[model samples]
Target: MLYSEKVMEHFTNPRNVGEIPDADGVGEVGNAKCGDIMKMYLKIDNGIVTDCKFKTFGCGAAIATSSAATEMIKGQPIETVMKLTNKAVIDSLDGLPAQKLHCSVLAEQAVKAALSDYYTKNGIDPAPILGEIGECAHCAQ
Candidate 1:
């Protein structure tokens, strides 16, 4: 199969599939690889990610990765959430096909992008904290 079992599961039953209109931070990233898009929303309270949601217009891999990513970061502290890596998301999903690896990168980037937005919107520079969001072949320019 092109996708792992976990990938199918998440794609079939994605978590946090909507949005939080009042989200403290929000990020929308487009995938250059397949021209897909993923938008993440985060609600932070007391430095904690009290809630998170995602909307992905992509393949099964993208939707699965986004679902797993939101599940991984929700309710976690910003510091912890910022440390999330694509490797972790890929690992959590068991494993993905080589071509689908870019999907995980989108998950991580979207989360950090949202966090960085949160920091920037709060008048605090995100560079010192979250560092650079990194350029991704999957992310748009």
Candidate 2:
């Protein structure tokens, strides 16, 4: 497979690859078909995402997608981050192989899952914010 230059860059040097000791919210998602697991950590302060991190155990596309997703949401308001989509992530990486499109879906789900967790932690129902995780049966989210 021919990978985009941007994909290679992010995969080789992933950003925000770590953990947040006092994370406000955390999400873990796995691709049932491939067993590609992704864990996302978020630190929200005053309705803004102060920081974001992730750990993905999968292919180069997975790592690159997660890295781009985190970079996209960091320092942005929670509302904006909520609007982040798989297409956006894919575009940010200059595109992924057709088979690896699911990686972008995982990245988007992982972030939403984390935001849902954040809402739950703050005593707010995630349904309004995230429309409930696992709503999509195909991706199990």
Candidate 3:
């Protein structure tokens, strides 16, 4: 498969490829069967995402997507980060092939899942499930 130079770069030298020991919140996503899985950690302070990190086991696309997502959310408000989408992640990386699109989606989902955990830890509920809100069943899963 052809991979973009940017994806190759990040995949070879992924940043934020670890976990926070005392994370404010943690989000874990993906299945082993899909040949990809991601676990994200975040430190939120005063409604802002002070730091973000992740551990991903997948293809180059998955690693690049996770790294990009972490970089995107750092120092941004949690609410703002929660608005992130797969399109934004892909756009940040220039683009990814159609087959690898779900990698970006996984990254986006991991970030939001982490944020959800953060909110729960702070005794607040994150927004309702995105897929459950009239979204297509295919995308929901």
- The lDDT of model 3 is 0.82
Root-mean-square deviation of every model: 1.7, 2.0, 2.7
- For candidate 2, the lDDT comes to 0.89
Per-residue CA lDDT of model 1 for 53-123, tens digit only, reads 99999989989999999999999999899999999999999999998888889889899999989999999
User: For model 2, how does the per-residue alpha-carbon lDDT over 1-141 read when each residue is reduced to its tens digit?
Assistant: 988999999999999999998999999997546668899999999989999999999889889999999999999998899999999999998888888888888899999999988888889999876775553243554
Error of 1 at 57 (Å): 0.9
What is the per-residue lDDT of model 3 for residues 2-90, given as tens digits with 9 covering 90 to 100? 77887888888888888899999898777777778889999988988998889998888999999989988999986688888889988
Clashing pairs in 2: 134-141, 136-141
TM-score of 2: 0.92
TM-score of each: 0.94, 0.92, 0.89
Better of 2 and 3 by TM-score: 2
- Global lDDT scores for all candidate models: 0.91, 0.89, 0.82
Report the number of the highest-TM-score candidate: 1
Q: Write the number of the candidate with greater TM-score, choosing between 1 and 3.
A: 1
For candidate 1, the per-residue lDDT at 90 reads 96
> What 10-residue stretch in candidate 1 is worst by lDDT?
132-141
Q: On TM-score, who's better, 1 or 2? A: 1
Residue 107 of candidate 2: its Cα lDDT?
91
